[model samples]
Target: MQVNTSNDVKIYNLSAGRSQPAWISERKRRQMERADVNLRRRIQLIQDFEMPEVSQGIKVSPDGQYVMASGAYKPRMRCYDTAEMSMKFERCTDSEIVRFLILSEDYSKMICLQNDRYVEFHAQYGKYYRIRIPRFGRDMVYQPELCHLNLVGASNEVYRLNLEEGKFMESLQSSFATEINSCDINPLHQLLMTGSSNGYVEAWDPRSGKSEGVISCDIPDLISNGSGLSVTKLKFRDALNLAVGTSTGHILLYDIRSPKPYYIKDHNYSLPIKAIEFILEGDLIASMDSKILKLWERETGKPVTSIEPGTDLNDLCIVPDSGLIFMANEAPKILSYFVPSLGPAPKWCAFLDSLTEELEETAESAIYDDYKFLTADELDKLGLSDLIGTNLLRAYMHGFFVDARLYKKAKSIVEPFNYEDYRSHKIKEKLQAEQSESRVKVDKLPKVNTALAKKFLEASTNMDGKAKKKARMVDGNPLEDARFGDLFKNPAFEIDPTTEEYRLINPLVSKIEKRRKAKESHAEEEDVEKGEKEEPTELPDLEENGRRGEQEGSSDSSDDDREWVAERRKVHRTIRDEEYMERQTRRARKLLMVDPNRRGKVTEVETGTVPLISGRGVNKANVKPLGARLDEEEKQRGGAEEVQLAGGNRQMTFSLQSKGYERGREASAKHAMERKSVHRSSRGIGTKIKKPWKGKK
Candidate 1:
């Protein structure tokens, strides 16, 4: 194995000895500053708790004092106290809880709908009672004033359970064609509403069990050319306002008095919405699907923000009037998200604000978090080779690190110019300019300039005389007005050079006078120099002879001949002797005539030619000609040639009338006719008899 001698690991000094480079410290400082700013601008996860199993449902209690969730693995329910931030109690049920509700604000009583068509009730300590319904329950809501518990499930009916009587009451039959999916009760008016799988929300009077009105939740634009949509969730902010979530990831807010929706919001995931709630006093609406959670404006339907938890979301509950939201998902832990802009943190977690503020003031991200460190060679691949020595690259150990934004900017700068984009941009600008220029503009004179306007009108009406011309001149030139006559008069004050103030101001006047005199003297000297002539210098005799020789050499030559000689001299000066000779040889070979049909065949005229200067020291006479060598090789091979037949058979044929041809043919015939005799050895094994040698001996 080969060992690496180069030190690839960097050692940083821990003590304050100034061992690190200045840029490293500077980069660290800048990263710390950036992280501090980002902390204050984004949402943060403050705390979390692990559950025994995957949480199926989660919700904050009505009094905002505790969080309750139900999960599997013996099918238990766990409640966490928000103030203490710990589990208050856990109770195991006979089956898994599909949905649950906290009936009392003091966390004394709770109701859970199990998957086995059973309704389980619990007090502050443990399980109190259980009741099995007719069908599997999907959702439930409790009305405090009527003391009635309403549950909707897989059937087209709403089952009512009176908590005061502790028994099942008369069930309300929904007139929907499909199964009921969700239901809600209006807080102010106590009106019952049930959402069906057929995309209809039916509001009923609970006292009479009669349908009051039906609202169609299907959006034609969303459901066009698609299957029918189902209502997954329904929330009522007050007596009149209602929010409906559909299977196609749409949230429709409506005023119950009108048939149309007030505004429509889409989750954009195309998944069934699991939960919808009105937070921040009904100003913002939060909707969730299995994929994403979104908070958007209720009045305008503009999206506020969204978060993807990278897991399947089961349910989410917002703390009463606050921004804190607790989510139950497929994971074993519940997640909480805080949106500071929506509302303040709950009083139980008020310390979170101070903790985040401290982090914003002191915490820092990693030094190379958002920067890409690259060497000079790596930068060349990105076309940033020209920026190696520039300040845009921060110098690190043996390379440089640039901000992500700066890297993108530099890469774009070095990119080739896009001529098509430039041309199109210019064309668009030209069109806009042409449209602007063709548009007519109306300019109105100020009402305060009535006198000037009157003069202008009079000048236009009387344009046939000198009086009119005078008026026109007065109207065109504002300075010709009588009120501006004093403005053009000369000032009364004049500078007196004999005074002390003038002397002080003009202190540099003597220097200016000296410069003028020197300039005049310099001009006179230049004129004197122009009038004189200098004597010529004599050339050396050798240089004169060389010049005369060049003149005589070109005197007898024509222009073309002279140009050819000069070009040849330039060529000789540029190339070595060997290269020049090779080029001349190539040119001479090209000039020779040859037949294309004779390709790969040697001709008599092209045989036995020796180069004048072969690098090897072999004598030219010792090198045999090509034809002579071929004849000698044929004699050594017994003048016989093998010809391949079409079916891969080989046939040997003798050459005609060649020296040693008869002897080679006889030897080949003898070898083909000779046969070895098979004999039995002493051990009774068969063996081949050895043939006698056919050599001279």
Candidate 2:
């Protein structure tokens, strides 16, 4: 039985009315408010979504991962993945139709039987285990009282199946001469009951496969009514009443301990009753026709409830404790009677009322506490007493009001306030963002040179015609032999160059230069404003030296402190030459082209692609000394400048910007790899049984 304990409501039960708190001081009011706030924060606990199938012959997996339903045209059992929004794993039977489903006691095996009297077994995890139907078979049950797994097959001949071996323990003849139509195992009595097509019932010994009691289900009064004698469905309830629905229309309640019927009721419908069900833990029997399902008491055989089965519905199941009856039909109708007082209260109803009460209180206080407006009749029409809460406000906004002006005015008054509050929040956010941008700008302020303008002017003039001519060498192209041909030039030739041409990195050099100039110009303006006199002793910032000394010297060293500056220059040159020599050797080895090849020698190499001098991978200045210099190579060795990697595949090429690129001959290779698993056969994953991590089997 599915008892829903979580939904038992805690209201006053209509016997007790709300009373005032013992003390109504302002302090007590604060405490109540805190408690109410806490209550609202907790997620409400309730039995939520009902299972989709009001499943008959429901077999839930012992591992609790699946639920199999047996009913409908061809019995269909759906397996499910038991996680949130659990999904169907697979259907049990391949037939696309099933009459009934019986789970073997082991649960590891499931039996799907069509009405032809043959049963098929699908092992829980293995498909190897299956059972063959015995001849002259009736009905079979795997478990009784819906309890443990025990196999029993009975007919004119009865047999107890030994499930472990897919065979029967023994076979025997029953006292009845008819094939069995249905069977029920009474857990309370520990006896297997069999009902035959010829209106006979018998109890069989489970172990020996012998008929223990011989009984007949015929009624003299029903015979007088001239209905054909056939038992439709039978169920043993509580070791007492045997509820049987017949093929005609009569339902008989028989006391299994006696031969006489305890009660009998004939259904009004001429059509045969299809199935019978007993609401577990409740003294009720339900019978269904094609159009309706009827419930009656087992002992009195009097009607308890009736519902239209929506047309075409022929079967149903009463939920364990929910009292909800799910009928199977075109759309699978699930219904619960609206009698809240009968059992667990509807969970949603309580929360709805509580929330609505709070909203109405707020709406009501907004009036009398300020200016009253709502009429009593209008308030009622608005479902203020209905406790609709914010839903009512939502519905009001959704209503089809025809007057455009009225809607516009209402929106202007109400929605605009909410929108304005939101926008003000956004404005504050924008101001915060601007403040962050200003802080970053301030931190990036460059150190200023006091005499930057004078230094710049002097430097510009020093570049006279000769200097200009040298600089002009780079005028048309800063990158001629440099390969770039000229970088950082104005891109007025292209629109949306960023989108069209690929850029590897941001133009940091240009940005840095711009920052330097801006700082210098600003410093000059600051000095002019302060009226500072230019001192003659203000020396030039060693502009003539370029950054050569700056690059090599200790940044803090004064010229006077560098007593061996001349020696250091020689030291730097020697280090550079040593690095150059090492780089050359390494390149020759990597290229595997130590001897001249058809590709030509290093000396004849074009300037655009200077073969890299390897060894220590340093710049041209460092590697020049490592290889034969231009001066020593004219005649003795016959200059060879071209250098390539060992494989002779990689060609060393560089741009003026020193951008390196890896080139490939083709996008598709000459040979493609076959689609085979990457793992070696020894990956060591298997299905071997082992001791579990937590000491679990």
Candidate 3:
């Protein structure tokens, strides 16, 4: 998904085992003479095969018998037989090829991805079939056990298709935040690993179709510095180790056992890495633009060497058995490099000492700069007799050694020291430190006692002897005066006449005021003697009142009437009678349970009077019954003894209709009101005439 913006990316058609040109051969020969002897002896320019079309991918068959090459601008996938080192057959596709792979255990057929949308399987006999995908696929991997080719699309969606049937079976949603750029399958672990353009590498379980782990490849500094790196290529060394190439030309090798990458290699050109692979167990090889190839040792993560193969390349592949590196480039040719078999040499070395020596002969000449024989007497004089045959002396002389054991003796300022010496040294250091501190000058400021400070400064000044003598002369004066003798006679202060203390009072009244008071008192007595007329009071039932008056003997005197007026006023100022009526009704309703025949006959008194005790005056005879028909009561009882209801003290209200049965009666009435139309026969035979009514005169 990452475009090569630094330079135009061109593909080439590649062929292997082809002879190189004369100029190329001469160049290789000249370089060999200058190369180190070990490299010169083992490395050789094997062959180069040139074609017309640009190659997009180059891969060796699983059996290693054929080398297949496909081009981005060409329709044919060419295969070269390793035995003959010549083109065997060409399977042509409808679209230009982008990548090609040989299906495992099916060498007779090969799969080609063209234009990122068409996937074609080409047979050896030149017949092929292709499945057109909906979107552009960035990378793909074949799962042998599942018989599905997992393709990663530009939108980060992964599609799994049955390779034989070429039908989409399932799609695993993207596990990354960006488009997938590269993908690989770990056959041993059965895990699918995908790399994205945003530097995320995620591992997925194909069987469960779930993401297992994820790793971000972008280094913090690179992204922070605005040089975000994208994953350009991914190669799995095995089930446990993975090699990743980034757009920033960084090679990262990750081990499944750890969260971080185990090895990393950075490049100077900052070109996108085209391919990455584990060539020989521990050595890694990576390729970039301008045919730049680099080799690194896995143990040290150090580059062994780098070379430019005289042209820009598209991709790289390695033949494991032959130790040959094949590169597809823009020159319409595949370049091959035969790696030297020599062990790595020191990077800075010539042919003379390119390889390190196995062992060294340790003798007097090799140990010391100059050799000399020392006598036992001379050794004793120099204090060297004790170390004459020991390795300590030998190591001190030799600048370099292969089989010498070296150690450093503990260093000390004093040859030997005891506890007393240590204590004395410490005391000396402390005294020195104290003396140094004492020599330092510190500024001091004057101090004042704030607590004793006076709240106010006195204005007094010291008096001279002359001022003190003058102060004694003005002591006592004014012995007496005429006004001072008369001060008591004239009242010390005159009281204001408006004050109550100076006011005069008299109780006598004049004749006019006394006459006015007598007339007013006389008028008040006359008004009391002539009182206003009173209104007459009438009872609700005059006949009943008359009968009660006869039985109770008209006991309504002025005192009793006044008492009733006061009691009525007191009752009006208190809580209303309605407050206790409901409670009293509930209590009296309980009395109705004692007489079953008293149900529905309860009535309330108008005056809210209830007789607490039988025959008491509290049961006033003037009270009127509420909510009961007097005529109906008269008919029921035949004017006999008044059968008062058991719960008759409660106030009542009346309505014409029954409340609890209204809904049922209305529903029944609605049903009875329903009528159906009946058609009468048009013939007169079905009609009957009505007869006239006879007068009852």
Candidate 4:
């Protein structure tokens, strides 16, 4: 014998009625007030009533006074008053409630079809009567006018039980070989509608026990896999409209007169649909799979709304004429959802409408709720380090929050490498490199002297015979052409005396000398402007005869004067020759330096060995000096003669000596003599001479 145990049963009272006792504690009162406020919110989960085990089914009575739910562990049904929203009573049964129906508004009479193929009837007090059926019942429906209970299960026939007679009655038999999964009765015509495992929905008349019509549902076309077309639920809005839920997560509505479905809705998850019902006076149809709850328009086949519960959903029932829906799931608690747009809250929770209004006015949703925040390191790992400072990532306190879609896209892009793309990119780079190398490139021209080129062009175009003759006459040279005359004649082509180029070439003329010359010129101009005049002094004159006699008497003094004049002439000549030689040497050095092959190969030649004539044979005023002869010789030799150094590849020159050349030559000669002496000593030390026979000597 099995002992009845109620130890595991639990009851929770979640009501927040306005009528509270004065003796209630402050905390309890505050809690009730908070619950009342939450219930007023538009669309929210208002209640979570726990059960002993997973709830099988839940429903609100026709009068909307109480909600009844059946569960396992104790195989009991609990009824919660709608006004108080608390468990009013619990009824324990021998078998678990598989499917249940409330017969009256008071919920005093209920018919529970158990999983053990038992049909149980209970009154307000307890289980009144129980009977066994041939097959396990999957679903059941009741007809009050006939006092009959119709059930369908694994068998091809639906079992009927007469409640008033309290005995078994004739079963409704279907001609199809498929087992019936669910059954419902049409209210207007009182015709029985049954959905079968073979995707057939058939309507039958109870009086005649004959088939009225049949719908194939074409389950293979509705699902991609083309399997599991067994209808799991059937709900009727009236005599003509019927809703069917299939095992393939499809909800099909049909008109009993037509075989094809009116509108078919997909739950998308493809889980077997658990329950379906028409709510709000048949304006909307509610369907549930194991994953979500969906409500859709009756006329338009568009989805009205949907809810994804935290747990797997087993059954759903919408409160009569209200948006509030109670859901039984694979958890100990029954979840309730409210949709304000579908309908208002029930009268018991009338404050929900006002609370939703207040919430809409004040509630603020967080902007980052849809974003995922990551730090710098995490971003680097995702190859999104470049987005650190970009607008795609919004900066929070320590990291950034990027849009979820963007993050997903970035992760996908950075995760894998395509070898084809890499190969193509490398090939493109190689082609570009080859093209760059093979393509001919031209050097950019240096900036042009526009004025000079233009003048040359103009002169060449307009040259006349007279201009050519005049240019030739100026120098009597072939290079003195009229087209090239401007190059020599134009002051713009000449180097300015005050410029750095002129100063570098003429190192003898110091800046102080230039300044002194400028001052002298300025003073002379001032004198000329002032019209200054100066008095001239008259020179004393001596007779020719008297000067001759004086010279004869003072011969020594005359000789001294002649010697002084000769010395002055010699010194002046030396200075002029040195300057000319220096200029020639510089020109030669520059020429040798420009030739790459003869660079650093030069020798200095002293041209000062020629004796000076003391103004004896040559006319002092008319004859050109030796310096002029040297200048012409240098020009004829093309600046200087090439001379190789004594050592291999050494730089030497045969150009004329410059200033400080004598000191450099003396130092080099001294170094050479010392080196020669050192070499002789080293040779002497390394060798030995032997004397014959006279060792002592």
TM-score of each: 0.46, 0.38, 0.42, 0.46
lDDT of 1 by residue, 130-180 (tens): 898998889999999889999998998899999898888888887763789
Model 1: lDDT of residue 485: 42
Off by over 4 Å in 3: 1-48, 104-107, 164-166, 224-227, 281-291, 342-697
Order of models, best TM-score first: 4, 1, 3, 2
Q: Write candidate 3's Cα lDDT for 1-697 as tens digits.
A: 0011112221111122212223234766566446634323331222234455577778877777777887644466777776655677666667777666788533587777777498877776765677777778767788888788987757676788886675787677765646887889988978888888888888888888888888988787544348577887888877788888888767787897677887777776678788776766445554454458776677786666565655677878777544455788776656654343422221211221221122111211212122233445544544455675664343222221112222111112222455787999999999997575444222221123111111101100122346545644222111122332333224434334443223221111223345556776888787876565444575478888889987674454444456556655554444345447868999888855553223244443353333334455653422434223344444554423333445754334222334557888988777766642344566876456666789997
Residues 1-697 of candidate 4: C-alpha lDDT, one tens digit per residue:
0011122311111121123323346786577667765324323223335466688789888888888898866788888886776688887788788899999877888888899999887888887878889998888999888898888999899888887887778877888737998888888879988889988888888887788888887656776885657788888887678888888888888887888887888888878888887775548787888888777778886666677655788888878777667788776667665566667778988876655434432222223333677888889888888877777777765788787788878777876676887899999999998676444332321123334444434443344558757655443232335765555566566545554445344433343455556776898798897787555476546587689878885895566557556655665666677779999999987875663323233534333434545666864422545566556545654556556667665434455454487889999999999998877345765457765686675
Backbone clash tally (model 3): 6
Clashing pairs in 3: 11-54, 11-55, 12-54, 12-55, 13-54, 13-55
The TM-score between candidate 4 and the true structure equals 0.46
Candidate scoring better on lDDT of 2 and 3:
3
Cα RMSDs, all models: 38.8, 32.6, 43.5, 39.1
Pairwise TM-score winner, candidates 3 and 4: 4
